[model samples]
Target: MSNPVLEIKNLHVWYRTYGGYSRVLDGVNLHVYKGEKVGLVGEAGCGKTTTMRSVLRILPEGQAHIPEGQILYHGNDILKMKPRELQQVRTRGISMIFQEPAAALNPVFTVGTQMFDVIKYSGLSKEESRKDNIKRLAIQAIKEVYIPDPERILNCYPNQLSGGMKQRICIAMAIVTARELLIADEPGTSLDVTIQDQVHRLLRGLVEKKEMSLIMITHSLGVARELTDRIYVMYAGNIVEVARTSDLFANPLHPYTLGLLSSVPKLTGGGVAEGIYGRIPDYLRPPGGCRFHPRCPRAVQRCREEKPLLRDLGDGHQVACFQV
Candidate 1:
């Protein structure tokens, strides 16, 4: 097995609101190895983004807190890092590709101005007419993402470019830094199918060529299959299953995972895809035992009263379901 570049162990997170604290993640455990592509897939509000933000220690300052757990990158705990060290970790270790490029990119600035600012802060262009070197690197990164007209792209504002183009710009910004890990949080949100496919292909190729680890946060099982080596199926703030992508797809162990795979729409004509019934449980007062038991068709008495630990079945496949 590859060395673990990032390890999240028994993670428990909570968000403070006016009403009370909402338990967002309950003893969640995830680890990504060097040069590995891992996928986190679940419905909205399932703590996918929370896990990524926690690693960066960039959670809403006073609104979120990690009551328990550890996030270690390269053997250093990010939660305990001083601000200066944390800043170094972000710039030199991890890069993030956000869901919406419009919000991620500065609306007031042109692409050239924004990318130049990043290159400046990166300390990569310190000598010999910084502006010229920054522009050259920015153009090269843009070209790497398969953008045909790098000069035209740099002159345009976020609003002037299409959704696909803006997303590509986001990828360019992320790749130019040469960080060790890239966390893509719904990187294909607003694009059409063809464009989304292009984005996924671009990300896969870039990660491989850069030899960087990737944490892909997505909803589509198809995208997960295409990009990830391993998959984690999350439901109600907990991981229900973890396995190799092909193994999980061929023989999904958890009921929640099976339900998720069934929910995907098919191109061929058929009856509507069946969705898991009931809404995500209230986080403030989540169900007592297993979070997925309420929606799982195979739930038993033990499933409702006792929580299941993620136990390895074989060949590194692990699941937290009593029935499995």
Candidate 2:
């Protein structure tokens, strides 16, 4: 087996908000081998973004802290890294595409200038040595994302481009570093169906051509199915089920996973889609035992009294439900 490029072991993060600390990530364990594509799917505010942000150690320092666990990147503990070491890992080892593209880019700066700054951190030979070389790299990255007018976009500010165009630009900036791992937190959530398809296809091509690992975080199962080799279903800060994409779509073992699928509007099913009710429990005092018991249809007494451990069910499938 190939060694894992990234490993998150028993991660627990707490955010010290005015309302009290939110147990954002409760023992989130995940692994991604080199050149692999992985998906993390969950409802809104279920710790998907939190999980990805924790890996980079970019969480608000005063507001959030990892109480326990280790984030290992190529055998080095990221949490223990010095400031200089962390900077190297962020720019040279991993890249992240934030959920909102416009907000990520500087509104005042031209796209080309912003991109050149990112290229500078890439440690590429031309990043600071030659302006023309950096420009060439920027143009190439933009072209890789299929933008027809690279020059026009390079001169424009963030407000000048349409949502889709801005999203593509954001993607270009993230991949410009040619890092080992790319974490895309809902890359094109605001784009129309047509734009989304095109962007997603471009993303797959880039990852394959570069042989970089990817972590796709989204609420859409369709996107996950289209882009990832394996999928992990997250709920209320815990991963409920994990399996190969084909296996997950064919045989969903967790009740929560089934509920998510049922909620999707199937063209063949011919009925209104079902929706999961009940807000995610308050993190100040989360539900005891299985955090999902109150809403889990198949929940038993054990589920209410004791947390279910994630167990391997052979063939790379894993589930945390006692009923499974």
Candidate 3:
């Protein structure tokens, strides 16, 4: 086993809200090994996006604060890196494909302009920083993602392209520079089913071809099952369960994980799909013990008093529930 490309240790992130402070991410522990595709699955507001943003130190400066935790990229702590070192990491080590392609792309700038700028600042050597070389690299990247007419597409503004095209452009930009890890935040959420499938396949192929570790944040368990090697089930701000994708689907331990698996719609015409009982708790005043205990069907008295830590069952299958 080689070293992890990225490792997050007990990350705690908070935001200063009008009501008080919201504990957005609480002691999140996650790691992505070299070339390993990991899935971060949770309902909305479960801090999935926040955890990834924290990895790049992109959280709102004044509003969000990391009281404790370490975001280690390779062996160094990202939380303590200087600006120049952090810039190096962002340009050469990691890249992110945002959830909304429209928001990620500058509507005003032509795709060529944006891509050229990215390549120029992508930690390229001085000899490779020429305008002609950058344009060539950009075109080649767009082509690799199966987007035809790269030159014409680059000349167009973001709004001129379709949703799927914009997403491919974003992917092209993310992979233009060689990176060790890529964080994809629901890249296909806004696309049609056909386009979503294409995008998913494109991502799978790209990760394999480039040998890049990936942290895919998604709401669709089906998508996670298809694209990830392992899955992390999150509840509120805690990771309730972690296991290989096959093992998780076959034998989920945590009650919350069970609920999530049960909620997935089946093709065999099972009655109506059942949803998890309760909504995620309020972050400002979250549950004291197990965050999911308020809705856990098998919760015990200890579940209401002690926060269970993730304990390994076997073969790296871990769950953070007292009953389990």
User: Against the true structure, whose TM-score is highest?
Assistant: 3
lDDT of 3 by residue, 1-324 (tens): 888889999999999999999998889999999999999999999999999999998998999989999999988999999999999999999999999999999999999999999999998999999989999999999999999899899899999999999999999999998999999999999999899999999999999999998999999999999999999988888998999999999998888888887887788877755688889899999998888888988988999999999999999999988797
Q: Which structure among the candidates has the greatest lDDT? A: 3
Q: Write down the TM-score of every candidate.
A: 0.96, 0.97, 0.99
Residue pairs with colliding backbones in model 1 are: none
Q: After superposition, how far is residue 36 of candidate 2 from its true place, in Å?
A: 0.5
CA lDDT of each candidate? 0.90, 0.90, 0.93
What range of 10 consecutive residues in model 1 has the weakest lDDT sum?
Answer: 120-129
Total residue pair clashes for candidate 2: 0
Worst ten in a row by lDDT for model 3: 269-278
lDDT of 1 at 167: 95
Cα lDDT tens digits for candidate 2, 201-222: 9999999999999999999999
Query: How many backbone collisions does model 1 have?
Result: 0
TM-score: model 3 vs. ground truth: 0.99
lDDT at position 86, candidate 3: 99
Q: What are the per-residue Cα lDDT tens digits for candidate 1 across 111-189? A: 9998987777764635833778889989999999999989998998999998999999999999887789999999997
